[model samples]
Target: MIEKIGNAIKDKNKSAVLLLLACFIFVFILPAIEFTSNMLSIFLFSLIIFLASYPISRKVMFIGFVVILIELATRATDFIYVQYLAQLTTNLFIIFLVGSVIRHMMNQKNISIYTLVKALNGYLLLGIMFMSLVAFCDLYMPGSFNSSGNSDMELVYYTLITLTTAGYGDITPQLPLAQSLAMLIAVTGQFYVAVVVAILVGKYASKN
Candidate 1:
């Protein structure tokens, strides 16, 4: 069973589908279950390791798994430093995975549904990466956002909103760092869209 699962994740298209499912659960479903709320960071980190297994090196995968185990073991202690490390690690892992996805998309000779799915996965991963950053800022620096008692879901919503450049203004960033992150998220989102579109169009044009 384990080997089967590993093989499924080894395929780019299959792994993209799995990542999308995990992202949907993290964003939409997990928040509804009250007990799972605090596990958000760990869940995201686990996904990082799982998705990284195929594209990244074995050494990186082992390191990520070790970090996840450490985070789980120390969950009861709630050490501020440990939490910071976990969040930072999660952000870095997602960033690397996103880069891998982009490189894979660019290297594809033909555009197809799999290519489109990979592009979508990359976009969602960007939002997830920024969400981790937002959470890190809020965790270490209280009052980073104007809203009080911000839930994980609320943070996810705020990140997506900022990523999409919707600017609803419901949950505005308070601190300078948070404000800067918001701008970075919006710009990164637009840049990803432009790059993906260009790659797809170029592939299509070349095929003609």
Candidate 2:
């Protein structure tokens, strides 16, 4: 079984596999589990940092490590501004890193299972990153959003909904900043799908 798993990973792109794992943890596991602890958050952050760093440059990886440490350190602090700074910087770095990975995948000019996986990972990561941004806005301005729950999982769900332009209307952003961010998230989702899907589909078509 171990050998089989190894072969499967080898068959696909390593980065894609890692990204998928991170996505699974964020989308499925985190939401399913109750009473998420700080330890769990740290573990999840570590896993994601590991997953995301492999495909990036050493310098980028170093910066990511630093940001993660900052987040871990300040996450428990009472200072809201400090928390926001860490979270925002970490999310921004991740967004840039994932975008870089997507660009790298596109440059390869061959569409494979891993390429598609990476594309999906990029999309999911966008939702996660923006969710953090919205959460940050919430930190400074409470009730920036109206939701059934204010947990991280709920925020993630809302982020996905906004990204897909579903607009279920259950969760509404109240603050102007939240509203603008939501709009930007929707537009970004549309643009990413249109542009990235076109490139990948065109490449696949040309290859065949």
Candidate 3:
């Protein structure tokens, strides 16, 4: 079983699949259930982070995991400045890790189903990273975002809507820095879809 887990970690596709599964559960399923204890959410998020980190660097992964533990340790405090700081730092690392994964996927000599999955994974991870940035900004400057910094689900929704350029206008950024970051997220999403996604689709079709 240990060897099998190691093999899965070494395979980008397997890691991507696991990440997607964890994300789907956390993003879609967990929100609907009314649970007073946050144990379920914590478990799902940790699982997602572990699986996503597996495909990147082990050292980076270890650091992220440590940051997560510290974040959890500080959760009970009345003042959570340190918790937000740790979250921001860990999320920045995650952004780099996901970018590395995307770079590796694009540098592949041949496209396959794994490549396609990795591409999708990159898209999802990119949105999540931007969401983390937005959350961090909100924590840094209270009322920077239209929504209260209370629910992860709301942040995920805002991130997806912003990435897709839907701009429902429900969660506008209040501060200048937040506005700039929002615009950057929108542009990055467009560029990714127009360039990277287009190239990947073309290559996949050519392979078939």
Candidate 4:
């Protein structure tokens, strides 16, 4: 699938570039739009899982989407509490897609992984950056902004702190919106760390 996309780009297929760009732009739109937490959760999650798995395997991706929907209905609505995580995940998927394309392009240009890793790393780091950005954008998000922690910057810093699980309690949420965000960060952060680290460790062990 990636190879075919690469060929299309190399051939300067205008339609193909536009299609990819459209998908790429969807990432930014989800964050910028003011969606209620409930609405955002369903829409964004479905969109992201669809985008990620669609290229590699449509059937498997469909199954993944169903599983996520079920999870949302049955268990975890915390996802909606901090829709920023959803936005960040969407942006991260876009970053990964863009990186994959750039890697393919560079591969054509015969660049080394030694050089490619730098770009890959930069895109991955954008995940962290986007998390911070989403927290800021929520200030403008349609939901009620509970003016907690004095300023937006303070809230962002605290969001990062909660996300990293560094709960020193210098700042805390006094409002429902802020508390929900904190809860989202705490749970989401743990899940993210556990899954990502487990995958990396599993890969290393298998490689050994």
Best by TM-score: 2
Candidate 2, residues 1-208: lDDT per residue as tens digits?
8787656444438756866887778766777675556677667766666566666666876888888899888978999788878887887887787687677767876687677777887787777678778777776778888865646777777888999999898888988889999999999999989998778877877777
* Per-model C-alpha RMSD: 2.8, 2.7, 2.7, 11.4
lDDT of 2 at 74: 97
Candidate 4 stretches with Cα past 4 Å from truth are: 1-153
The global Cα lDDT (0 to 1) of model 1 is 0.75
**Of candidates 4 and 1, the better by lDDT:** 1
Residue 128 displacement in candidate 4 (angstroms): 4.1
Pairing residues by index, what is the TM-score of model 4? 0.36
Overall local distance difference test of candidate 2: 0.77
Task: State TM-scores per candidate.
Answer: 0.83, 0.86, 0.84, 0.36
lDDT of 4: 0.48
Better of 3 and 4 by lDDT: 3
Give lDDT: candidate 2, residue 69: 91
Error of 2 at 186 (Å): 0.4
Query: Ten residues in a row with the worst lDDT in model 1?
Result: 32-41
Worst 10 residues of 4 by lDDT: 113-122
**lDDT per residue (tens digit) for residues 23-133 in model 1:** 777666676564444566566658755774555566767776776676566656758787667757756766776777678677878777767777777787788778778
Off by over 4 Å in 1: 1-7, 32-45, 74-79, 204-208
True-vs-predicted CA distance for residue 25, candidate 2, Å: 2.0
